[model samples]
Target: MLRFNKWSLTPFHLLTLLLTLTLTLWLLNVCFNLPTWLLLVPIALIQFLSFLFFHTIKEKGNIAVVYYCGYALVIFLLFKWFNSMAITSLTYTQWLGSFMMVPQPVFAYFLSSTLMLSSMFIALIYYFVIIHFRPMVLILISALPATICIRMGRPTVSSYLFIFMGILLLLYMYYCSYEAEELPYTVLPCTKSYWSTMSLLLLCIFLTCSLLLIPGSNLSNPIHTLLRTQVTNHLQPNYTTSTLPKESTATSAPTALSDTPIFEVRATKPVYFRTRGWDYYEKNAWHVKREALSLGYQLPKSEMNQKLEQKSLVLLNVIERLEKNGLLQDMPELTHLLEAPISPITYYAAYVTTLNYSHYMYLNPPGLISISNPFSPLDLYLNALEICFANDKTRPYPNEGYVISYMDTFPASNSREMLLIESLDPSTYNQLINFLLDRVWEQHNLQQAQEDEYFLKKCSDEMETATLHFLDIPNSITKRTYDLAQKITASSTSTYEKALAIQNYFYNGEFTYDLNSPVTPLDKDAIEYFLFESKRGTCVQFASAMTMLCRAAGIPTRYMEGYVCEEYDASKGCYIIKQKHAHAFPEVYLPGYGWRIFEPTIPATENEKSPLSLILLLITCLMFLFILYFLSKVLSEQLWRLWIVRQEPKIALEAIYSRLLKRLKKNGYVIEVSMTPINISHILLEQGIDLTWLTEHYCKVHYGHCSCDKTVVLQALQLYKFLYHVHP
Candidate 1:
């Protein structure tokens, strides 16, 4: 039989047990959505029974208790699982649907269970193998709850409190261990030092409450935006689709437009900020099919026109700032610039403020110009004139600024002449057609050889097959798209004329531009519904309709998303881009010429600010100020306490003595303020502390006419330290 001492059930032991139980209950409440009262009853019962059995049972009964607790916990988990009839009866699809519905609580429960089981197992192993229970084990257990909270989305105040308490418990245990070595018979002072325990508990509560006052709590706070980009940009994908893609990609438009400036672009002329270009359209969404390949920096020619060379220098200066601030790192290697032949044009400079996407945005048909701060490395997805950077690791840092120099290219000057073939006489048209066909055949043979070499060399297959991909359309396209395209361009002769006719069809006020339009039926094709049935949609619908119409008309096209540089900031001498400026448009491929931008949708009217919106904004500002004021008040109180202790030594001593008396009384000592310091010292002597010299110093400072000296203060501090470690 194992003999239990009275000190075994010390206040420190009970407090630690209570804290552990509370943490378990709190996790169950947050993760499983279990009621506090429901969890409290079972947890309290288990803790009480465990404490009772621990104190009463001999060593032989330890294994039985462990087995019983484990079995009971398993039974409880099984009961909870089987209780949910909806979960039990679910088919695979139904199960998946249900899982998504309750993913949060389910994940939370799993995390909580794992933490509890792991803690128990760790404790049991330490006790059996090492012959002692180490409180440091709890420190490791703290990580589980913190990780679970972060995985659930964000860290809550409760999660942080759990971590803080675990740390506090570990420190207390360390203190106890040291005391045990110094005085083997001494009991834990946690209960004896009642005032100190209560003070620390209150402090923890105050700190936890302060955390809750922070905006978004576990989500993005004010400090986060100031330090880095908005949390949403880091977590979510760069591009998103909305029912009305033209209006907003988000579910609904924000009630009030945020004046938060996203980025500033400094350029001679305002240009479209193109991020990504999409090729495939299906079920109201646009997707990229090919993966981007990484291409390291390829050096550009230093010798160029004087004007372009000057612009490149200026761009390099801006890139230096971006790199210095840890924004842009290195440049990307483009396939067209490396493998395919390209002609250079004029170089231009732009200083951009924020980077929301992984790829660099540039004006279409970029040539071989050098970047100031390059991407760490670059990933290239080459499909016609559509170039994209897919390496997120090397992308620009979020919210940081960047500057780049890019050379813009123009299509072949005779591109228009090729389109003018339909207007020529039959002899001229046939002769021109034969010459072009023969030229195309010769180019095809050369391209085939290049492709074979590219494959043999293990070069990017996507870039080699770019033209084939540009012309490929999904087989899901309905006959209505082809019929509509033929009807619209029936009078048109050339490919350019057909594209112009299709663009005109949408611009002719036949389709309404509605941002708040109802979602298209899922059963119907998005482009078909937008074109034939619902002639009302946003930029997404309009762009999709045009892309499909052009494809049906034998004109290859690609869908693109970027910002329209409409609003210029005159004060900044640049363009200020906002989230509202995000737009989607289509690029039409001309055989000889590259992809050309053609706007099909009418510009949307700006939303008028309402009086109600202004009132809400004002109220929100006031509420924010109130939170700041509340936090200031809490902080001030704590500071005031420290000031009082520092400035008034005599008053501080009295307060400490009063707290000591309360602690003594809690430990079953009959302490009274009326008693002299000498009498108090006599009672404390029974507990093995000699405070006679400290009592005389206290009297000299308070009762006597003598000023308090450093020696007296030092003695008081030493006495307090000794008393702090004394057990009942």
Candidate 2:
């Protein structure tokens, strides 16, 4: 039997419930695009009824059955009465205050059915988030709807994130409430005194506001973008059924690829039209790894057998370990570290027209932005492609084809094309790494991630998963391949630079691009064979070698293949793409940009850039630093408090004494280092100021040689309060 706890409803409880529920409803609506009143009105109604019903019922299960029955009967009557009205007019917003305005009674039925569903959900949220403060249950309930929406082709992740933060707060609130004796209310964390509590509260206001307000836009989210990348990589292949040639592969020997024209492009400039990016490379094959069966469709048996090892999907356990141990005061540094730089993105459109009926539609590298056809469109921060997975007869693309928009950050002329700044200057990243390492081990994070449920893991774990998937090298890849990659990119600092260096390495004349190359040995990895022994292969080998080498050099790279439409028919205005133009290349996942396509088979084109990117980089850096300046004051106060608390009694007292003198000096007093505590007190008294209490304690510890103990420290804390809390 589901039950409520003994705790009474407090203001903190109500506020937590309201904020969490608001976030939950917003995300749920994003998932289903539910009518505002349909979702809210029912949930609000259920909350009131549940509050009333919890007092009356011994059996809570009976209420759900009754609500659902009411829904079925109401729907039946509405549908029968309004059979003539279209369902489109039945939207909640379509009607106003009058029943006559909503001629469609079927809307009543839809409302009733949803009302029943909302009652059941509100009951769970009431039990978990509001009453019991159980994060796992609330997270489970919130995640299910979001997951369903993603699979149904509507992916909105922002809702789930807000709820996660809310859970942390409520969990902390639960801990704070334990100090009932000291707290004046049901929830604020109690220090020993009211003034210290005031200090703590002010500090919290600074930290929380800094965190929630600073992180802007959905682009800051990598898991959200990576999810789109994973979705496109897996489902896109199932759409194009024609034996039309696919490009992402490396064969030991070259075969005469057909020169027949496959697709035509109408664009301002030439672009590499990629079918999709393959993250896994093994046995000379660019494989799209199947993490699991996805989008309600099963992969072919050949592809399904070799699945990547499933990883932990959750971060709550690791967070539980981290938070349970830290004083509730640990969030300041986290907020300080998390603020990253975001640059603006501008998008350009590329039109792809198919000439052969069997040819697959090729998209630009970061994946699809949007297609012209009325297909499964989605809004991702990364703006990735969402391909139709229905059977060929019912596929979304038409015979004429679709247009894909590429972001300016697109590496190929184009494309986060997930990251704004991968580490945002290594200092912040190092701080994060050192903090994580100091707290936990590598194996623990992974284990927790493996056990985590979908859509409920850490940002770091998902970020790790997305990057590491592309970095894996099969055993066939030699150490020399790794060494060569590292050696070539030795001077490079960023992913793009490393990628550029590796791309240009092939052009150094060490490898040959031959269509009639000799077959590579079965004993060697195809890339290793090409780089060392054979040294004579086409775009296939060059692309594959660069892909592995980049991975070895600690850069996440994927092999991409599709037709290159460079031959422009200027009179016709669209570039003519041929089957012979079917090409393969390496795409490196640049930190600030999204997945970028690089031409490693030939010398990389010297990508020209306007001064805007440099200007954007400098501007973003300044903004990050500007925010950091404010966050630092909070951190400094917190650190000083920690420093005072942790030191020896004499040192703690001296620290407070030194701080008081510094504060006075800042206010324009010309006190010397040799000034006596008595002399300072006299000068302060002469100026109509009184810090006699603070100076007296410091004088006892320093001049009288009186012992400084916990009592003296408390007195010094009172002294510290007058210096900071009473003044500036």
Candidate 3:
């Protein structure tokens, strides 16, 4: 539940908050290795703005959460569209493809995303930590970034120390807030509540220490060890290491994917985990060439290390020179960051295989940048077109699969990039890639250029070969197939447009997607049969047909087999990949850019969303609760009245008199907690209010222990009216 309350910002509150935020962020900067002043200044702005917004709004209860969500959305859009650092003429998708589709995210891009994230987090901390003082929630927020950095291996182990201390201080503040009654619980400070609070405080301390310390990582504490092993293993998705043995073929009998979950994946977004890419089509089958199968080249780690070491020195010199010229204040890693390519369009995904298949290996999605396993260095095989593990080689795979950082955006998926790619001369993108390569060669490490020049050269060589390799169509391709491809793309100008045209051809309502299509006659070519005769097929058939057409249309195409995970488990915050999610698609090479996927599978219709359902549900829940609360209050009052009336006459008289004094006390007449009715009468009389009749009856009922009747109660009521000068 969220509440927006206008807080009285005392000096204590303001000072402590400033100190806490500065310390926490500075500590976090230590963990993240981000520039300090840049992060600090922006977050302070966000905090001030957020504080003003919340302070202005006086709404309370869960309705405030809706406001916060809307506010968060506005912040997201503001940064997404208006961020000048990374903005270019490219559309969002195009930008993602061209600029971010690199090995690592560039400086400004990383900072922009981080700043957006921090803005929202500051709003959260202001609400939960400052306004509410929820220690559990605050601790969770602190642990989250630290956990991510640890999982990604971005921050050093020593960085956890800063995070630990920062979180501990914040938690202590929350504890103090509660003790001072600023965030007192519904229950008062009784023995039970005292013990509970103490227990909770101890738990918070332990958790803060344990998470930052990474207790599972070679620790002596048995409790921490148990929590690490028991809790994590239970929550982790159990995916078997054995991959589903589904073979891709142009000609095969109809088949359906199995429901058995062969692997489980945990990723923020849905993606295609491609096994491999097929180059040529012949004899009614797609085939991988020898070059495609072989690992083309590997970069020596020493070369990367050497380049980094050189870049560091060069960057330092540049910063120093700029500082001497009064051009800049410091490097703070800014020089190297600016020289880096645009933000790499990638996010991290971690998945673990359930059954230990002796070797642990994750089926990383296409467009993978790097991967990591828990125990061993990743045993990987790569080529220009695609990547996979070296299955036959002697290498250790993590027993629990691995984590991958990947980006898999298709340039043709967006209109602007598609048009741009289409309009570009075939050699434009290639030349751009070459220019970047030579630019690297000309700068920094010019003396030992060959040492750091493997990947770009390999990509260039592969590009030279892809033309002859990917266009080799089957001899079985009929004249009608070529004619259809030509006819579809007759109006389309470029290779990207032609690929889209081919893809659109299958998505038209005339074609049906059938997983269990009848077997192709052995004599008929499968592509021809599917186009003219069957006119129905699974993803394999549709993708195969599209590939064949694109190839005939003089576009380089490859058959790609992969599993597309769509089923998202909101509970676990990851996607679940099953055997039934297997899919096949064609990768059409966009000259200079690289291979881009075109979907020819059955078109998934758009399902538009409306906020009406959620609004209605929320309204209903609140209304029901309001009515329930009203009824409960009335019922409790009636029960209390009934109980008092059912007492003995003497007791009833006293109770009746007690109500008059309670009313008198509300109007500035002083009364003691354990005052006699006579004492209250005297106290009220001094305030020019008399309750003598109540004093007499209450004395006779209690002190005399006499048999009092309804008349005494009646007298007390009359006196109560007279005390207020009302007619009875």
List per-candidate RMSD values in Å: 20.6, 28.3, 20.9
The candidate that wins on lDDT is 3
Residue 430 lDDT, candidate 1, scale 0-100? 35
Q: How far off is model 1, as Cα RMSD?
A: 20.6
Candidate 2 Cα misplacement greater than 4 A, ranges = 1-249, 293-344, 359-367, 374-390, 394-399, 410-462, 603-728
- What does candidate 1's lDDT look like per residue over 201-291, in tens digits? 5565555455443333322111112111222223112321111112122111112222334455667776765554665655455655543
In model 2, what lDDT does residue 622 have?
A: 61
TM-score of 2: 0.38
**Candidate 3 local lDDT, 1-728, one digit each (tens):** 32323565543345335644554464445333344555767667666676667665535557777777888888777677555656345444454344311213344554555556556666766666556665456556666655644333223223334444445454544444344333532223234544464465445445444443342332211112111221222111122112322223676344423233334466666777765566767666665554434343332123432222122222223333443444443333333333433322334555543311122223546556566654356545444435344343323321234556665433323333333455433465466346445544544445534433554465456456767678887667878888998899999776777888899888778887664467789889878888899987667778889988998888878887666777775644456554446577888876534667778988433341123334434654665575467447646644655676577777777776766666566656678888766677677678666667667767776788778777766555445434432210
Instruction: Give the per-residue lDDT of model 2 (tens digit) for 368-447.
Output: 44444322332211111212233444332312445566544332221111232332222343344345444553333556
Q: What would the TM-scores of all predictions be?
A: 0.41, 0.38, 0.41
With candidate 1 superimposed using the best TM-score fit, by how many Å does residue 641's alpha carbon deviate from the native? 20
- The CA root-mean-square deviation of candidate 3, after full C-alpha superposition on the true structure, stands at 20.9
The alpha-carbon root-mean-square deviation between model 2 and the true structure, to one decimal in Å, is 28.3
Off by over 4 Å in 1: 1-260, 289-346, 355-370, 374-385, 390-393, 399-402, 407-467, 473-476, 608-728
Clashing pairs in 1: 246-539, 330-374, 330-375, 331-374, 331-375
